[model samples]
Target: MHTLKRVRLAIFLGILPSLVIYLGIAVLPIAISFYYSFLNWDGFSPAVFVGLDNFIEIVKDIVFWSAVKNNIIMMGASLIFQIPLGLLLALLLNRPLKGIKIFRTIGFFPVVISSVIVSLTWGMLYNTEYGFINGILSAVGLDAWQHNWLGDPNWAMVSLCITYIWQNCGFFMVIFLSALQGVSNEVIEAAEMDGATGLKRVLFVTLPMIRDTLWVTVIFSISNSFRVFDLIYVMTAGGPAHNTEVMTIYMYNNSFTSLRFGYGSAVSIFILAFSLIVIYVANKFTNKDN
Candidate 1:
């Protein structure tokens, strides 16, 4: 009985700090946001309770919809390009070749760098006048392809997506590499022996074995894709004609720039809800497969 009491006390003491920190850092703000979502507060004056008005305004806001659409595009682009490229890179590096460790390190270097640095680098690279990309295009007699990539609304989002893929693919490649290592070699060898080759082997054996890891990677990639802000902000500042506005950017502009705290909170709540739904649906299928 004394041992049980001491054990309980030790457990309580260990968890007490975590509970306080969680409430202070995570739970408290979420609660405040939920409370503020129903009120009109400019961050300077008293909050006025305007229940559901913010939500109604959000529904009617064209810019909000545009931001949402842009996020969806970002998410789709990441799904289509980032993970597949990461997987391919991981597969290539998984083999034992001369200086392969150096290649793997190079692939992961971008992820360790700050997003601001990556964005600035890419921004300069996309510069129309004397940027490396345009310089190369002009040098190669493809001057027509050299335009203001970041300034053009049609290309701004695409350009940002490319930068995002370049920045994060390394991290996902590491994740896939770890997961790929866990794949049973004997299973792969047996499949190979049964006449499965190349794409067929990957589809029939490797993919199914790594299904859980793929689902996890996809969920995280989707979340990160949807939450993109720094690259877009540094590169386009939501851009020439608001062509690259995402939900978080919209929220930031409303909360900080426009001083519409209540409205921003409402937008945040919408984003949170949407993201939760997406992750939930994804997990439903993923967990079911378990």
Candidate 2:
């Protein structure tokens, strides 16, 4: 009994720091936000208890709904483009080619680079007058395709989505690559012996073997889509009439810019609930598919 107690104590001590950090950074703030969501405060003055007024106002705000729509669009783009591109890149790089390490490093380079730098670089690339994309169009005699990529409402979200995909797909590539490496060589050889090669082998054997990892990437993609802020903020500031505004940016504008602490808290709470509900539905759907 004494030995068992000593082992438990040691294990508790080992995890105590992480537990405390999680509580301080995650649990405590959530609790505080929940409390603040019920009040009417502007970061100063007396906080008036407003109950559900803030939430009701949020529901009525069309701009808030627009931000929610933008977030959903971003989520869809990430799922459609980022994950598949990452998986494709991973599959391409999973072979025994010469200089493979160099290719893998290059593929993952964007993910390691700072988001601010990536945003700024992409911003320059999307510049209307002198951007690389427009320049290419002009040089190729397709000048009509060129427009204000970031400034135009129609293209802002699309541009941001493209940048988002380019910047983060490398992350999913590394993840999928690790999962691919874990797939048993014996199973692969067996599939090959059974005449399953190339696309047939990948589609049927490899993908099913890594389905769990794919599910994890899906969850990460969804979470990252909701949490996206700095990249879009630095690039467009959700600008050109808030065309690319997301829930996080909306929460920031309300909390800090507009100084509506209560309203911002309510927005944050709603974001949490919304993310959880979506993730839950996705989990159920993926399980059903399985």
Candidate 3:
């Protein structure tokens, strides 16, 4: 009993710091933001209680809706591109080839690199006149295919999506790779003996073994899509008429740029609500599928 009590006390001590930090940084700020959402205040002025005004204003703003649309686009692109690409890369790297470790490192390099640097590098690559992409098109006698990649509204969101995919696919790749590595070699050999080879083996044996990891990556991708800010902010500042604006950027603009503390808090609340609702629906769908 004494030893068990000591172990339980140690476990609680180990978790207490993290719990406190989470409450301080995440829960506390969210509570404060919820409180502020009901007020009318410019950072400096005395707050006046104006319940639901901020939310009503947000509902009426077309820009907020546009931001929501862009966010959905980002989420869709991440789901469609990042997860599949990552899984493909992981499958390719899960072999016993020579120099496989080198290849794995190369595949995961982008994930470890700074996001700001990745955004800037991609921004240069997407430049209108002298960018690598347009230059390639011009060299191939396809100048007609080239346009202002980042400057044009038609292509700005597309450009951001491409950049976003490049920056984060490596992260999911590493995750999937770990899950694939954990898959039992005995199971794979058994599948092979049963005449399952290549694609058939991967589909029937490998993928099912790592099903939980795949779901985790899906949930993470959904949450990360909502949290994307610094990359898009640096790349376009949600520019070209806010074509690439997301909820986070919208919240930042309202809270800091426009100095509407209450309005921004209201926006934050909406962001939280939207994130929770979408995640909950996704969870329900996934559970039903399972």
Candidate 4:
């Protein structure tokens, strides 16, 4: 008991500083934000209590709904594009081969780069006239395909989705690669002995082993989608007339641009609640025994 007590005391001492910092930066702000959500304030003017009014307005706002739709699209795109591509590339590169380390480094390079840089780079590539993408289209005698990539309402969100995939798939690739390396060689050999090879090996032998990792990545991808602001903000600022607005951008515009602190706080609370519920649901699905 004394030894255990000593260990506990050491652990407490070790964690106390970090715990305090976490509470100060994360927990306290969230609590304050929740309290502020129930009021009317222009961020500077005196706050007035207005119970449920902000939430009610959020539910009715057409722009809020639009932002929600965009967020869903981003989540879907991440799952459909990034995760699968990551898994596929991880599979391809998991083999013992020459220059594999180089390939891995290249795969993870973009993830280390700042998101702002990625957005700005994509912004240039999407420019109407001199952008490489449009230049290639025009060169191929498809001038009709060349337009203002970020300005087109129909394609702006699509452009953002593609940029997101390019920048993030590498991170997931590294994750899935590490998880793949952890899979048991005995199980793999057993699958091969049972005539499972290629796609069959991957489907029945490999994916099942890393199911938990996949779910964790999915949850991460979904949560990241909810919080995505910088890329879209840099690329479109949630425009061509709010075509690319997402939840984070909506909250940002309300809190900063419009200076509606109370309403923005309410939006932030909604973001928190929605993310928690989604993550909870995803956790349920991640249970391997089920």
Top TM-score: which candidate number?
2
Q: Give candidate 4's error at residue 128 in angstroms.
A: 0.9
Scored by CA lDDT, what does every candidate get? 0.91, 0.96, 0.93, 0.93
For model 3, the stretches where C-alpha displacement exceeds 4 angstroms are: 1-7
Q: Per-residue CA lDDT of candidate 1, range 157-203, in tens? A: 89989999999999889999998899988988999999998889888
Model 3: weakest 10-residue lDDT segment is: 281-290
| Model 3 steric clash pairs | none
lDDT of 3 by residue, 1-290 (tens): 99999999999999999999999999999999999999988899899999999999999999999999999999999999999999999999989999999998998888889889989999889988789999999999999999899889999999999988988999999999999989999998999999999999989999889988988888989999999999999989989898888999999998899899999999999999989998998888778866
User: What is the overall TM-score of model 3 with all chains considered together?
Assistant: 0.96
Between prediction 2 and prediction 4, the one with superior TM-score is: 2
Candidate 4 displacement at residue 53 in angstroms = 1.3
Residues forming the 10-long window of minimal summed lDDT in candidate 1: 281-290
Leading candidate by lDDT: 2
Please say which candidate is ahead in lDDT: 2 or 4. 2
Per-residue accuracy of model 4 over 97-215 as CA lDDT, tens digit each: 99999999998898999999999999999999789899999999999889888999999999999999998999899999999999999999998999999999999889989988998
Q: What is the alpha-carbon lDDT of model 3 when measured against the actual structure?
A: 0.93
Clashing pairs in 1: none
Candidate 4 at 39: error in angstroms? 1.9
Candidate 1 ranges beyond 4 A from true positions: 1-12
lDDT of 2: 0.96
